[model samples]
Target: MEEEPCSLVYRLEQKYLNDDDAYMDQDIVLTNFTGSSPCKMASKRALELVVLNNANISHLGDVSQVSGLMQHVAEADLAWNSIRWECVKSVLKHLPQLRTLNLSYNPLDGEIAVDLPSAPLLHTLILNGTNLSLTSLSSILKNTPCLQELHLSDNKLDFSDDDESVMNESVKTIHMNRCRIEDWAQVVRLMRRFPNRKTVFLCENPIKSIVHQTPVEDLSTLQSLNLGKVELIFQEFSQKKLIQIYNIIDFLDRSFNDTTLEAQVNH
Candidate 1:
């Protein structure tokens, strides 16, 4: 029989029994400590809310250490780290109860493809500043059916003609600002497909023009349309085209102000 470390023993005792218990009722725990020791200790206790903010944690430690702790965790923010896709997948496997995941500012590159073992209860997934491609995006959407809000702003999402079907009806809001998306027809197709989408951010894209010839049937579902800085280049204009854009804008304005649209979906 060997005695456990002083810190581990103390943490175990406090986790099981303590008034205003640190481990049991802990909402957030942020530390900059790196290496396996701190992670191993932190993963031992059950926490409903946790924040490993600004940590140097890069790799996946022992998976068994973080098994049951996921059910109790509601929110976890591991932003501004050096974690990659493999580490992210390992961490996500334990977080069955996670609702919000912020992986912004990580040094992740190449395609972003992940297949979770179970459907994540995740609603918001922030991938800002990660090098993600259309293939990665498709993979994520195909796997995470419950994902609502996705942030891919400031990444390289160059969409070809073949990637049109990736933007389906499941996603609510998508931020693709500064991604240099030049195809307006593809954008129109996406909007038409996802009539129930809440917001579509297309800022800073080289969109020459938006020829909205098709009559929009369900504009009541669209909330925000960020086309700022898009070069709307119209070659041959028609009366129908002008009216269509105007109608779309009007619907967007109404949807943005109306709170009912937000209540329509439970993501």
Candidate 2:
């Protein structure tokens, strides 16, 4: 006979609320949890990170469960769950101090329209592999007034020619890796949309050749840009005009090397 599945409340208590060793760690991670029961962990104000990834959770059945436990959570990872856009709004309502939220791989494609609650403190939001649309992206920008970093990688984003420009002043970094962006002009439009963007990753897109042919003026003011698999044609541009782009490429190279070195050192 198979052993019984642990309740979410019991698992949380065993790992965080009751464990003496976990007292120093202010994280509550319950991945692959199938229990439908509400997490009744007594309010733990000290907790900062709450990860419920791949839990098959559609919604927080009890709002009190969220309010009492995740009120002060700074980062929440609810990735690979069955959560909708409305549920995200509810989570934001309770998690007032949430600085980073990972809602990647959630089934949000069915949401025709949504109005997210104001998340003034939210800075980073990951929506990778969520099958998002421009309409949903617009709603996200409207609510996350102070958002600085956005991850929309692995999604099929089809921006039409007639779409009006969407601007958000606070957004400084964006990750659009593997987004299948085919047009160089579309890339320029994206940059314009996020006027204050300092860092942008458009890796694995089909606009590599177009990037080299585009005017340098179209790509100025960017501090860091990752064009993965997009090689630069150094012979086509003058050294003075290409210096900024060269610096960005050098930065990406150095960042990769540093990360590799750190991993090697740890190993």
Highest TM-score model number: 2
Clashing pairs in 1: 208-232, 208-233, 209-233
Highest lDDT: which candidate?
2
Encode model 2's per-residue lDDT on 107-205: one tens digit a residue.
987643556788999999999999878777777778888999999999988777456576577898899988877766677777777867778888766
Global local distance difference test of model 2:
0.66
Clash count list over all predictions: 3, 0
Query: What TM-score, computed on C-alpha atoms, does each candidate reach?
Result: 0.63, 0.70
lDDT of 1 by residue, 1-267 (tens): 843222222332344334343444443442332454333435555555555544555765654544554556667677776677777776677677777888887777666555545445778888887776666656655656678887887876555546456454567988777766666666666555455577888776665455545555544566667666543432233656555655655654554455221111111
In the order shown, the candidates' Cα RMSDs to the true structure are 10.0, 8.8
Lowest lDDT 10-residue stretch of candidate 1: 258-267
